[model samples]
Target: MRYLEVTVPKGRRRAVLDVLDDEGIDYVVSDETSGRGFAAVVRFPLPTRAVEPVLDRLNRAGISDDTRVVVIDAETVISQEFDDLLDQHSHGGTKGSRTSRQVLRTKAEELTPAFPIYVTMLLISAVVATAGLLADSPAVVVGSMVIAPLIGPALAANVGIVTGDDGLTSTGFTYQATGLAIVVGASIGLAVLARLAGLEPAGVDIVVVAELQERVSPNVLSLAVALGAGVAGILSLTRGFSEAIVGVMIAAALIPPAAAVGITVAWGMYGAAIGAAVLVIVNVLSINFAALTTLWIAGYRPQGLFEVSPTRKPTYAYATIFGVALLVLAAPLVGVTLVEFQATQLKSAADEEVDAVLAEPEYNHLEVESTEVLLDDDYPLRSVDRVVVTVSSSDPGPMPALTDHLHEGITTHADGPVVVEVRFVVAEDREGDASEQIVHTSSGDRDS
Candidate 1:
């Protein structure tokens, strides 16, 4: 069966439709008015490709003037099963690659995931995400990602679009939007309470920030990751590949960023919170865009038993959505690039200082370790801390001047006068390695 929807100017709709009726075309009509013109939609399902000749006939009849017709593939006819499948898909059914019809048929035949399970999954996700942020454990964070029930509303929005099921779509988005709001709200509240009770937020570290910072760069990589995960998600939905989809969920990293934003806000880290918020937006936009695009490309359409008019309005609506999504996906990348350029400049300054210090004659075996780069000003020693000049050979002689020079050089190089503590170890010292050396100072050194 084939479905064809045509849009005609209001003035010629009645005449064009009459010609279609006389030709024995079965179709339905809908009238939508734009600024100054009316769109008459005519839909019909025919077994054969009989639309082209009819359109040619309409052109000869002068009805084709200011009219456009498009043919879209509707895989299966509408049925009770189809309606139910759309509901399930839109309302957080399992990740599967089933054609929209297959999904419904399977739902009809199999045990569906119950509402209780859905709620449980949601709670589990929220709890896990919370714990992951507090613990600063990437493993825990990824686990939270795997368990997030956030996909429900996003999928519902897509299903709603394809099937033109407004209620299901709106309900789905509402649930998601509300759930996210609640989760983020509770997290911020918890953080505020903790601060009020004189509790410190978790350790601020790069790894933790990496897990939490989503909105920083909505770049090509983010889009690719979301798209890849979306395919896996759809495949899991259609093919029962739950385990793979779970990993995809983790890689996609949807929930942690929002939780991070809440925690950051509680800690009074506005910049971090902003970054986290960006991450949440990027993930949401990327996931929805990728998922819907994949579904549409795979030929999932609304399963209404009745045919409706095909108008530019629906197509334009989709285009607009895509345009917005594209912009969202592009944001993070731009932000990241700007940030990286700034970081490179800072690192260049620090590196030049390190090289100058290394050139000093006293320290022959200078080694610099600075794998970490600090992003936040609140934590002073982020990526900038340096360990220079490890003892490479045995030295029986005291080298006070050399040690002082190293300290002085570092202080000058870094621009800001950082507190410097020096320690010494004999090159062949067996018990105390350079890392665990004892410091000898006139005013007693501090090392704990």
Candidate 2:
């Protein structure tokens, strides 16, 4: 149950009271109170189900402007007469009541924070994400998600656009863009500092840590995750559910990828950085698009009829822009996916070929340890698979023959031209009284 205290102009009090009476709502009206400007106060108790309808009626009756309506939660209403009244209204279910537009507007306004808090949270989230990526810790990454403030402005952007509030739209966009910039820039600065301190992941190769790698190569699947998060986020907001879980979902699509971009940029891996940057862009657009669609379906619209027609053109334009961007982003993702698939196939074939070659009588003592198909940087566009085989052998005599046979087998089974390289480790058997022991030592790579 909700207790509403409404103050309206003195002349309109009777009309408002009549509407309340028609709705079967019990109320008490106090007229011309004190220093107020000819105002009357009408206090009423209403069932949750009737709140939206009552408010809508009052709004249409011109009681919304300047008139004050404050809703207070009724903990306990005890009276024999009121109990009967409540029982009569209880037949209509109150679950999932639609929130008033005024409430939603207030919510949007509250979420649009002052600049300092927004930038601070963005920087903190970015630093946390960077540290998580460096440590390859998912827990730390999720911690970052929990603190991320990006989802607010993202949803706000959708809300503003849908409501045709230019000020809200501009504020949302400005905050969102500024937050993203701070996150990326701060992450890059941290990465540079880490590198300068020799704290970066050891080696010149691109940081292939689990967190970084996962975000650096986003595909169609990533977009889907972002879109789903966006929908879930708006649903949570409108339903008055916990926003924390939904915030995590949005952060999952956003934070790590942005961190990846910064880390890659700091490391000077521009190609990988491009992929990470694309992932961030795709996720942001996908979230906004999904939220906009969800809000529209949820019956959210601009304030006035005049505003409705004007909103449509900009809505379509934004939707089209997002659609085209998604299509363009998919192109590189598709290429990356195809290349990865081909690499997997080539690796499998190479493994089988190496096993067969090592199974030969002359190379019987050799054991295949591992096989990997890596992209040859020299001919990346051509999709040349470099088959690297690591083998342990007791005899060195058959190594040459083994390499040739492995190369022949791999070249035949692989889809494209494959460059076969064999790495040999000599295993020496030592005779012992207690037990037989073997020692393996690397002899280095032998190209075939």
Candidate 3:
């Protein structure tokens, strides 16, 4: 519910009052004595969802650019008629619950902080994210996201573009670009410093770190995170949900990968850095694309553009640009997906071979433990580097022939050269038994 106050211009008071009366909205009219607009002031109460459409009607009824309209929250209304009006709009779905463009625009602007503060917050978050990635601490990484001021600029850009506020749109874009650049730059500086101070040892293999490894794999799944974040962020902004939680989600898609790019580059792993860089780029584009589409579908459009063509033209243009850019960036992600799929198939086949070999009578005492598939750190697409299988047995023997047999069986499923290694773990029972336990079987009987 909202309490609204609108100052009507001269000669437009009757149309305004008639529109209000037609909708059964209750309002109070007072004569304008300040002599600024030379008319009457109308105060009204409305359901939150009814504000936009009712305001549009008032506009068509001759509200001018100089007209003053103030919308504020209304806690309670005692009128049964107002309750019926609220019930009607409540059943209208998204359009009913959608925040007015006036309010939405204000929220976007408020979310965007001052320039200096924005940059400072961005740098701090980036440093924390970089440290968290290196330390492989998910909690710290999430903490970094909480303070990130990224959601504001990210959604504001789309909001401004959809509403045809050119200045706002431009400022939103500038803030986004500036914020990301600062994050990347700060991460690089910090990572390099960490390396120099021996916090990260020389010649370290950064990919071995679990958190950093995830950022280097830019697959189709990565796209979903970014798209979902963008949609949720905007929906939260317009639907009166907690934007702070959604803001963390937006940061999750961007901040970690952006930091990974710097970390990998600082470690001189240029190929791996490309993967992280592509992920960051793809996420940014996908988030923007999803945001623009979601806003349009929610029936938001340019306000106060004076002409319909001028309003719709820019909105369509911005959407098209974001959509096209996202598609272009998705190419590499698709490639990565295909590579990962093939690698998975190869690993599954290797597992089956190990199971079959262990089923043989001669190898009945050996129990399979784990199988690992390693891949190269390449951009867009990576290939299997090796497959290692670990088996456990208590028998005191070399088992070198098992390695040969396993390698021969696994390589048949590979399209190219893939190294296969086998490891044996000696087992012992709690009863101090180090000998193998074997079960002997006959045609119709089995014995242990």
Candidate 4:
């Protein structure tokens, strides 16, 4: 429940009361008040659901500027008349619960803060994300996501489009672009510092840590995450849920990729940086596109008729932009996906070949333990595939012949050239027990 104290000019008292009465709201009017412009105070208690519509109606009735409206939380109301009034106005739907245009506009305006605080949070999040990515720690990465303030502007852009607020849209886009620039720049600076401190790998070769690799190559799955997060974010905002949690979701789709771009850039891996940048671009477009679509579907629009057409123009423009961008991004994602698919197939074939080689007569005592296919360092561009085979045996035979046989088996199924490396783990029987044996290992690489 909310308690509203509204002070309007004497001439506008009836107008305010009429709106309240129309909505079946009960109020107490104190007329002939001794204050500025001989104003009157209308004190009303209302349900939470009715707050937005009632406030919007009041603002539309031209009492917003001159009227001083203060809303206070009401713990309890023990009036039968008020209860009856609420019962009379109550509807069995979400029509009355939707956030008003004024409220949404206020929220958007609040999100576009002064430059200093925005920059501070951006730099801080970037640094935190850099640390997390370097350490390859999920917990640290999530902490950075929570600290990121990027979601505000992201949703603000959607709000601006829905409400036809040019200033809001411009502010949102400006802040979002500026924030991203700061984050990327700060991350690059951190990378430079890390390099100076001997924290990151030197030369053109990137250390293929799990976190770094994940962001450097995006596909359809990454787009799906951004789309879902975007929808979740707008829903949280409209439903009056916690923005912080939703913000984390949005940050997850954004921050790590941005950090990856900086890290790759600092390492002078421009090609890999392109992948990370594409991921970031795809995510940004997907989030905005999803949020805009969700808001439009949720029945949010410009309040006035004149504002409606203008709102739609920008909506279509933004939608088209995002759609085209997504299409452009799909090319790279599709290529990456195909490369991954081929790699998977190659790895599977190599594993089968290793198993077949182990089943041969001379290698019957040996078992194929594990197999992995390592792609070229500059994958998707250079197409060299390395098949590493790990095998264990109690009674080992000559490795040269076995390596040649394994290589032949793999190359038969491989679409391109493959480098086969056989790692032999010779296990000796201990105390006449074959199952429980002491093991000695020797590795040899044979390229074909």
Best candidate (score: lDDT): 3
Q: Select the stronger candidate by TM-score from 1 and 4.
A: 4
lDDT of 3 by residue, 1-448 (tens): 7899999999998999999989988789999999785599999888878988888888889875568899998888888878777876786543345789888888999999999999999899999999999888989899889989999999999998888787778888999888888888888899999898888632488777888887887788999999999999889988889999999999999899988888888888888888898899888888888998899898887554475568778878877887888888788788878878888998999999999999999999989989887787564467888777878887756575677778788888887877776667666667664444333222223233
lDDT of each: 0.54, 0.74, 0.83, 0.77
TM-score of each: 0.55, 0.83, 0.90, 0.84
- In terms of TM-score, the best-performing candidate is 3
| lDDT of candidate model 4 versus the reference | 0.77
Candidate with more favorable, higher lDDT: 2 or 3:
3
By TM-score, the candidates rank as 3, 4, 2, 1
- lDDT tens digits, residues 137-172, model 1? 678877877766555555666556555656655666
On lDDT, the stronger of 1 and 2 is 2
Candidate 4 lDDT by residue in tens digits, 1-448: 6688888766767787889888877788887547578467888888755676677687776675556777766888888767776665467532343455556667667656677988898889999999898888888989999988877789898898988877788888888788877878888899878877888643446548788887887667888989998898887777777878888988899899999899888888887788888888899999999999999997778765566787788898999999898988878888777777887888888877777777778778788878887777663233545777777776554467887777777877777666777776666666543332222212234433
Q: Is candidate 1 or candidate 3 better by lDDT?
A: 3
Off by over 4 Å in 2: 1-3, 32-38, 45-53, 72-94, 304-307, 351-364, 376-384, 397-401, 412-415, 430-448
lDDT for 198 (candidate 3) = 84
Error of 1 at 165 (Å): 2.1
Clashes of each: 19, 0, 0, 0
Estimate candidate 1's alpha-carbon lDDT, on a 0 to 1 scale.
0.54
TM-score of candidate 1 relative to the true fold: 0.55
